[model samples]
Target: MKNIYSILFIALGLFSCQQEEITAEDHLISYDIEEVPVTEDYTVGALYVVNNWSSNIEEVPLAGHYLNGDEEAMKQHILWADSAAIDYFIFRYSYPTVNADNDILSAFLNQNTDSLLNFALRYNFAQMNLTKENTLEGQGKKEDFIQSFKDMIPYFDQPTYQKVDGKYVVNIIAANQFYCDSLELVYHELREEMSALGYDLYLTGEQTGWTPPARFEHYYFNALDAVTFTNMFNNAWYDRHVFLPQSLDQHWQYSKDYYMDKEGIELIPTVAPSINPKISNPNASTYIIERDTNFFWSILNVAKKNIGPSRTIIVNSFNDWNFNTQLEPADSYGSSSLQLLRNQTKKN
Candidate 1:
């Protein structure tokens, strides 16, 4: 009987030892999880492409039909975008509207902080969006917008999750010079207020003619993560070398070199689909996007190679009617582009 009791004690000791071993393994599993490889084949790891600057420009908050169409109705149309595993959604909202609704903004940030800090936020400056002002860029509204962001920075600093560098992203689109002029001073002040916040700002502009000085020169570009281009053109204007297909790599290389050497910063890549103004605006100029999925795939491949990041990529837009680069799951394509994005993102 004494021998039996001794055997029971030994078995209990062995079980306790095994339990300790399992707990230690679980604690170290994340660190032990194979690090994301940076091999040639290990592409498309962390990348993204948004269609355009997004906006919650809804004045009435009518549930179904939003700024463009009905919410429930549009989902049926969001075929391609339904399963798109986009890493970050740079949701854009006008500065003026944010300025007016401190309470709403605070509530929104609180609710979304959980999701957005994990994602990305690219605040836009659409003067016509917030107010009925035809154009604020012409009327010293730049300063007003800058002041608005100064107020916004503290909120950006207090987020649930931030980028890999702990910096929050803010993007501006439009007259590059005007916005930059406002931002240069604003960011400096913002940095002071939120010293611990290593927040960065991104400035995007339409490729204003290929010329000197690059037009958009802001003091903050030096402190920015990247400067992106919004390709508003169709087919990226292929170089018709005697009707032969010009390699996308060759043309982009020169552009990349010039942009990097001259601007002293890397540029983001973008591929667009069809841009039809008739769908949304009759006055806007349209571009011919013959191949949608192939174009998207090519750009994704290029971005994966050049950026070489597991995440953070740019797309022309998800839905911009005037330039018609929407990926919002149309009944026509039936989620083809969106499915491709998900599948490609999942690939080796």
Candidate 2:
């Protein structure tokens, strides 16, 4: 998905896990997967709270505890994976304060002990784009967005936990943001630069079939290695307004099948039970609904069936509350959602 900043070419594209151990007290909890324990190659985890989670600063909830809580989350996640024996998680940089080099992300990646979950970060060079429009803390603009991203590359250059083919495997996100035409121009440039730095790039997007099949094919389909479509069904009303209880996977099978046979693009299948925007300020024009656990697992099953070998299955999100497609353990379903994922991965 590409984001049209109105300031640029004006289109937009938009856009983890853990493990561990055996415990009796953990058994008394609601997360069904929490009770059982498994040891397999599967890794299932969630998006951790960002450093901005400290509230009113930038993002919401400010899950600062995740700075340390991730270890616990991993412990709990591993316990739940018992059903599916999940061993890997697509984790990302939610807390940049811990270690910008991804050292914070890698610690959990080691999985030195049993009943543990492994990880990789869905890193974003765009965070540097989070800076002020022209300065460090002013406002944002499309013209400045490019430089913002280029500046953030140093952080990801460091060695982290999980490496693919040797180097750290990072799901470089929002490569298609700003505008598909213009932003991607920046992407190729960044890709070249990052490659020179010896970093591997895994591009994810939703252009595979967002429009008439022709347009999708012409612009987005064959352009990248993986496509993690937005877990959203908004803007369906032809722009102006959006309605929630959004259909994330609506018509999703068509995409899964298309990417599988037609484009042969690696499908990073993302499944979210639902989409919502209630968590944001009242003015937020986005969604605000959580998903149903069963639906999420259904997508997981779909991913397992479609992807193989160089598998890079990307769940809709580990923590995307504002637009509401988070897989992290929350009050509503507790650990039921994660349990379903853990169980399904074991089958895969």
Which candidate comes out best when scored by lDDT? 2
Candidate 2, 136-221: lDDT as tens digits: 22343433443434444554443334454554444555534423334445556656666776665555454312443334544445
Instruction: Encode model 1's per-residue lDDT on 1-348: one tens digit a residue.
Output: 999999999999998988744442243211211122224332111111222222421111112233332234333333223346544434454565644234323433444423522334455566534332433444656557656666666656554423534455555454353333344455555555455444454433334222232445452254444555555343333332111112333344555565567565555555455444344444434435543665556555555445512244565565443345655544456556656666555443
Q: Let me know the TM-score candidate 1 reaches against the reference structure.
A: 0.58
Cα lDDT, all candidates = 0.44, 0.47
TM-score of each: 0.58, 0.54
Poorest stretch of ten by lDDT in candidate 2: 238-247
> For candidate 1, which ten residues in a row score worst on lDDT?
42-51
Candidate 2 global Cα RMSD: 15.8
Candidate 2 off by > 4 Å: 1-46, 49-86, 91-115, 127-168, 178-201, 206-223, 233-250, 256-263, 283-294, 301-312, 319-324
Clashes of 1: 20
